[model samples]
Target: MYPTNIKMKKKDKRKVAKAVRGAIKAGIKENIKLFLNTKKFGRIILAKLHI
Candidate 1:
C-alpha cells in the first residue's frame, strides 16, 4: 500500500509538471508572436505584410 501511494504521488507530480511546462511554452509563444507583430507592423506598411 505504501509503495503504491508513493507511485501515485510521483505520477501526480509529473502530471502537474507537464501541465506547467505546456502553459509556460504557450505563454512564451504568444508573447513572442505579439512582440514580432508589434515590431514588424511598426516599421512596414500593412499592405505589404503577409502575416
Candidate 2:
C-alpha cells in the first residue's frame, strides 16, 4: 500500500493540538476519546475494559 500524503506546517500542527486540547477540557472522557481515535475499534473494547 502506498502512503497517502497529508500536509501540515508548525502553525497547523499547533491549531490541531489546540482543538484536541479544547475537546479534552470540555468533559470528554479519555476512554471515549481513545475509542473514537481507534477509527473502527469503537466502544466495545473500552466498555469491556471499564466494566
- Among these predicted structures, which one has the highest lDDT? 2
CA lDDT, candidate 2, residue 15: 99
Report the Cα lDDT for residue 6, model 1. 42
> Number of the top candidate by TM-score?
1
Residue range 1-51, candidate 2, lDDT tens digits: 976786788899999999999987765677556756586566555656765
Against the true structure, candidate 2 has what lDDT? 0.74
Task: Tell me how candidate 1 scores on lDDT.
Answer: 0.74
Q: For candidate 1, report its TM-score.
A: 0.61
Report, for every candidate in turn, its global Cα lDDT versus the true structure: 0.74, 0.74
Q: Which 10 successive residues of model 2 have the least lDDT summed?
A: 39-48
Q: Tell how far residue 23 is off in model 2, in angstroms.
A: 0.3
| Cα error of candidate 1 at position 5, Å | 14
Where does candidate 2 clash, by residue pair?
A: none
